[model samples]
Structure formats: structure tokens, C-alpha cells
Target: MVVYLPSLTLFCDSLWTKKMCGAVVLFVFMCLTATTHADHHQPCHSPNMTGLMNVMSLKGDKIAQGTFAYDSMGKKLRFRSNESYPTNTSLGLDLLMLFEEGIFYEIDSKNQSCEKKKLQMLLHPLDIPDDSRFYTTMTAGSASIEGEGLKINIWTGSIPHMKGHYSMSVTMGCLPVSTFYFTETTTLLFSNMEVELEIKDPHLLVVPPFCHGEPVEDTPEGTVNSFLNEFM
Candidate 1:
């Protein structure tokens, strides 16, 4: 079964104005309060072998979009676009090859397949930070992932434009069994604005579908608008 999570978009002519900054500050306070309250309850359970599988798709203010598929067994496949803005012609054309674990596949954008030599590199795992407590922060953006199950969060601002934060949790059941809890916050200033995305699914050591042709460029504007509306 497919579950569609709500998507959000924020449009501001200028995030640097004093009024916008105040609104952002209030939003952050609310998020912190909500998170604090939720933490007091039972911790969220990670996905397991018997849990449901899910696919999560995310689009960020026309800057980036991607999709991830996850099974109960900590395995996942992710595809991310390279374009700064989503394009009707280039939608789903760019891909970032990622494995269930932290391993990255050598992507062949032309053929849309993994290169043999690149797959060989999978003999070893990629070097990723294992610290689960480290939380990256952001504002006015959104992210999603599925490992053992699906986890996603959306924030309200932009990098170098606005300030906000995002949170996520996912479980993977590969070999050792792992779960991830992640959080990130960001503050944008005139000089620089940096947003960090964190994924913290934990399991010991795990070892880890395709629609044909390009996405239709002339997809009706009404359909596209409808899809965007569902998120709003």
C-alpha cells in the first residue's frame, strides 16, 4: 500500500526582514516545545522484519526532490536529483545511488545503472559518522527516508534565506538490526546559512524497481498543481 505524507512550501519575498525573523523565531519555539513534549512519551519504535515497507518522496522549494524505498529489513534504495530546481524535462533523470547502509553506488547517469567497477567498491563500507546524538539543524525545508520503515519531517525556511529545523527517525533490519533517530536545526544570516540533514537508523552490520523511460515533461499543470496542493 502507498501512504502519501503531506508536503509543504513557504514563499517569502525576503526572509531577512525583521517581521519574518520574528515569525521564524516563534516557529522554532513551537517546534522545540512540541519535540520536548513528544520526547516525554514512549520512544518511537524502529522498523522491523515484520513491519510495513514504505516509499517516501520529498520536494524542497523547487531546489531538490528525491524518493526512497525501504523494507522492514533495514534495506533501502534512494534516488536524488542533481538539479537545483525541479524541471519537467529533467524530473527523475538525475539519480544519486545509495545503498541500504551508508555505502554509495557509483552512478551512471547516462545508462541509469550502477557501474560494475563502482559496485566492486562496495566491498567496503563508506566512512560515515556513527554518532547518533549529533543533530544537524535547518529551517524551511523537508526530508524523508525509509529503511526498516519510513521517517520524514518538513521545516519552514531556506538556507541563506530563512531559519528552521527538521527531524526524522527510521529503522532498518539488514543483518545486525539498526534504528536511526535524527534532528537538525539551522539559523540563516546574511553572510551564510547552512542546513545539515541527519539520519540515525541503528542496526549492527547489515548487508543490503524501476519505471521505464523519462518522466513526461508535458504533464498537465493542473495535475502538478494538484499534487502540490495535497502537501499544502
Candidate 2:
């Protein structure tokens, strides 16, 4: 005699439900463990870290209008400026500022033909919190300097995610006589986006008096004059 199992369908359905629940529980546990691991290895919140980001952004007018990313372990910094709208001009300039053991290197872009003399001098990284001081200067056909401005202090507890603020002034000049001030604040994001920079008080800058002329290489002055005359 053959016996029929009438409750087989119900038993199979129960087994499928149990397996699905077990898989969901396993996924949840994995996610929790990953989050805990990340929390354990996360960088400690520091006032100096936030300040560094702010100082980098405050350096110049062009610096304010770009996206900045930094790697803490690698000590690598990258910034890219969005091209200005309506003009469709490329404003992207890449700087690989490697900060290794209190030293740095500023790499120039391909389009720009930079001689070694035009490079900026390396300065000590600014120590945040108690002492916020950093010094560096760049000289090309023109010169500009980045340093810690007055009234920089670490502000804490404004945001849970942010560590602190580093305030500083940025100055640029063609000649030492022509200079402008830009106030900035750096916030430590403490996540994939490590830093956030906000320009607190930005002042409209005026270019200093400087010479501008194309070199008359192999072309005579009169030949250039005739070309100008044709345009006129």
C-alpha cells in the first residue's frame, strides 16, 4: 500500500520561509559588523585636521571655486575647479601637493610651462589648536603667498560630524604691494569626504600692476604692427 503525504505542501512552504528569514538575519549581522569595524578604525576627531582644509581653500580666489579632496594616509591633496559657466572655458588645474614628513611638492600642469624657479617653496604644515601657523610662497611671472591669518581659533561642538574649525586669511599679489585678504573656515567631515571648507568673508580682489606683452620672437615689430593695423 502506498501512503500519500497530504501535508507535504505546507511543510515545504514552512521550510522556504525559514530559509529566507535566516538569510535576512545573516545579512543584517554582516552590515552591523562592518559598521562597527568602520567606527573602530575611524580617524580621531582633531581640530587641526579641520583647520588644514580651511587653509588650503583660503589660499587664492581660484582656490575658492573648486572641489577639493584629501587623503589622510597618503597625504595627497587634489583640487579641481569647475569651468565658469557661459564662458565654457577650462578652469581645471591639478595640484599634487604631497605632504610627507613636514615637506611638500607642488606639481605643475601640462598646459603651463613652468620653470623650476617658478615653483613655490615648501613650508611646515600648520599645527592646529594651540598653534595655527603655516608659511609658503609661490613665484612665477607673478608671486603669491599663503599663510595663517589673524583670529584663527578652533570651534568645537557646532556639528556632531565636524571636529572643529580652522580660520585663516589668504593673500595673493603680483608685487608685494598688491595684496588681498580672504577669510576661510575648514570643517572636518570625518567620513569619505574628509573635509569641508567655507569662505567666511571673501573680498573682491584687484589685480596688481604688472607687465603684459607677447615676446617678438623671430617676428619683426612692423609685421606685428601691420597685423594690429589690419584688425583696427
Candidate 3:
């Protein structure tokens, strides 16, 4: 049942359509700046609720790779994101977050250190039709994938499932193109999905033993903001 990701060290994780953690951050930002940020418009349909899966996202020269695992019965997720920047040094950021426990771990792969902090939020994408202006404009079309045309629903505006200005694609049966979506232009592609799969790795739910890092004492809001400020 464990899908071995041979590319885990490189961009194996970040081919998702949306950045799950980024949306969690954006939702917080939207809540904080509600007075300044207007809805893209409103939706006429029910909002989309997120469950979990594995996906990758590509944006400009930067690459965000992550694995989003969810336990629907338990109502939480085990996730990680590695964002790579196009620099001579090829700087990158690696992270891991476990819901339900409210633990956020930032892994310094090179230094082999990790920062653990207490932070928790129900990270799920709920895109109400009116959450953004373009929610109503979402059009359903057939996108050719691997020479096969599949019926997909596409929308522009801030991502509906999570938050941010990304185009989103939803396949039939209400499955999101990936686990995350933002910027309609950021392409979200799927590599694997185990909707009925539950996370079994205990290590994924806690800080690794190899990293000698201390836990940070902070509120969920405080810790989440600190984590977001780095990339957002």
C-alpha cells in the first residue's frame, strides 16, 4: 500500500496542482484582510470540501512539491512541501505539518535540523461559489490528458478549494485535480491518489529522529504566520 516515491529527494513531492499549506496561509490572510480584499465574486453552487490525495504544482521557475495525505475518518492530514527557487545556489525550503496534533515541523535537510512548533488548523479546501468573483464563471470542458479526453470543471480566480488566485480543475465525481489549487495559471497535475488510503507512517506525524531541533512554544496563529512569512 505504500507507494515508493523514488524522486522523494528531488521534486518528487511538489507536482501538486495547489500548495496545500499556502492555501491554509492565504485563508488566514484573507480573514485578516477581509476589509481590504474583495471576493472574486460569489458562487451559486455548494462549496467544495477537501479530503486528501497526492499531487504536484509548477509555477514559473519555482517548483513546489508535496505529498498530501488525509485520514478522513480521523479528520486530519500528514503533509510536506519542498519549494525550490532558481538561484545559483538552488535554495529551497522543506516543511512538514500534521493536523489534529497541531504540530508544524520545518526540516533543514542540509543542516539536518528541524524546528517543531505547535500549530493546528483544519486544513481543507472549501470553495464556495461566491468565495471569489470567478466562481460563477467556472466552465466545464474536456481536457485531453495522455491523449484521453476527460470531463473536467475549470475555474479562474482565487482557488476555490483553498485560497489564492489560481485556476482550478476538478474532475468528475467532485475530485479536485490535485489536493491544492491557486492561480488559475498554476498547472496542477496528479501523479497518484489513494482516496481510501490512511497514513500509516508514524514518523510522518512527528519530527524525525535525525534532526536535532527544539520545539517552539507558540500559538497556532503565531507559528503558522511565522511559517507562511517565509514563502508568502
Candidate 4:
């Protein structure tokens, strides 16, 4: 069985915006981001460079746009994502990546609701006789790329399908600019990575007002959480 967990491949959301072209199906394309941090629940210093970045997808459909900031201690991110539905109606599901006690909150600003889930180091299962082909190293010019730096050399590939890595840059540190959901036959891309080296405001990482009074189902300790909805 193939298990899906919040690794790197999902990117659907944002801070300072509520723009989700809700059509139910767009929710199928919804992606949540949870990357490596120094520690969760515990407070830490912000990364050297912190700034807002744009999230993009190939084939016309676009994910939510958001910002990210990190430090030597931990990281914080927020975004909303959706596809072009004919409704002309926009409903963005806001998310706040504030991890506490192995948990973080995914919010729906439109509904003024929030759901929390645990942070797990998720792995994927891939079937390939030559596993080496799934990995590669490259360096190029990323002047227009977000988080672009002196050189653009990084490793990228996918574990079957989930946890698809699309972008990686190392100027100040090893930073993952974006993720993807693709098979050997299809592909998706993320650009304008916008990596900054600074510390972000700690208060901004807090959950928004919408999630203030919402109840949540917590992920039990040591459970393999395939998705946040698993707890929902």
C-alpha cells in the first residue's frame, strides 16, 4: 500500500491573503508544507534570512501563495492553494505551521476554522530496480528563481509519488524551495523561490483568530499520520 504523508511534495497555501478558488476538486490539489526544524513546541531563534516567497505549479493550475522564515532553531511557514474552478468564488484555507508538542494547525480562514495535526518524519515507498536514477546532482543559474543564490546545485527526485522534491538551494543553508506530486510520466515545477537570510517576527507564527476557538483532534503519539485529515 502507498502511504502519503506531509513531507516535501505538498505546497498549497499563505499569510496575508485569503485566495482559494474553492471548487471542492481544487481541494484535491491542496498541499500542506512541513519541513525540518530545529525543534517543535520549543521556541528558537529565527533563521538568518526570512522573507515571503511565491509558490507555483505547472500546467496552468496554481497553489496558494505564502511566505517562509527560518533560523538555526526552528522554522515557520504559511500559505493557501487552489485550482481554477468556474465558480468565480474564492475560499482559501489558511494554514499556520506552528508546531507544538508534535502538532501544527491548518486553518480555513474562509470558514474561520482550524485543524491541528502532529509533525512526523514521513517516509515513502518506491518500487524501482535502479533506485539510483531517482537521485541526481545539478548546478545552474537561478537568477529568476526564488531563493536563488551564487550557485544552484542540489539533489532532487521523488519516492514513487509522495514527498516529491522539486527545488533545493544552498546559499546560507540547505533550503528546500518547493515540492511536487508527479510520477515518472508527469512533472510539476516551482519557481521564484525567494530565499532571504534574516529572522522573522515570532508573533506572526501564532495561529490566526479563525482558529482561536476551533476544536481539534490531536494525533496520538507515535502514529503514522498520512495526512492532517487522518486526524480530522
Please report, in order, the local distance difference test score of every candidate based on alpha carbons: 0.25, 0.24, 0.40, 0.38
The top-ranked prediction according to lDDT is 3
Model 3, span 1-232: residue lDDT tens: 3222111113432535334544533342243211122354333331212222333344322343344544443433444543322333222555565544666666776777777766533333322233333322122222334533334344455432234454444443444443234433454433223333245564554556765447575555333332223333
Instruction: Give the residue spans of candidate 4 off by over 4 A.
Output: 1-49, 80-91, 108-112, 119-137, 142-149, 157-167, 172-187, 208-215, 218-232
Clashes of each: 26, 0, 28, 23
Worst 10 residues of 3 by lDDT: 1-10
Instruction: Please tell me which predicted candidate would have the highest TM-score against the true structure.
Output: 4
**TM-score per model over all chains:** 0.32, 0.26, 0.43, 0.47
Q: Identify the runs in model 1 with alpha carbons over 4 angstroms from their true place.
A: 10-61, 80-102, 112-166, 169-232
The residue-by-residue lDDT of candidate 1 on 1-232, one tens digit each, is 2222222222122354435543553463355312212232222222322111111222122232333222333443333344343445323422222234333333444664542111211110111123222232222222233332222221121112112222232212111111111113322211001111222232211122122232323434333211111122
Worst 10 residues of 2 by lDDT: 173-182
Q: Candidate 3 vs candidate 4: which has greater lDDT?
A: 3
| Model 4 quality (TM-score) | 0.47
Selected candidate, larger lDDT, 2 vs 3:
3
Model 2: residues with Cα > 4 Å off, grouped in runs: 1-63, 83-92, 101-130, 133-232
Q: Give the lowest summed-lDDT range of ten residues in model 4.
A: 123-132
Residues 143-165 of candidate 2: C-alpha lDDT, one tens digit per residue? 12343121111211111112233
Candidate 1: worst-modelled 10 consecutive residues by lDDT: 187-196
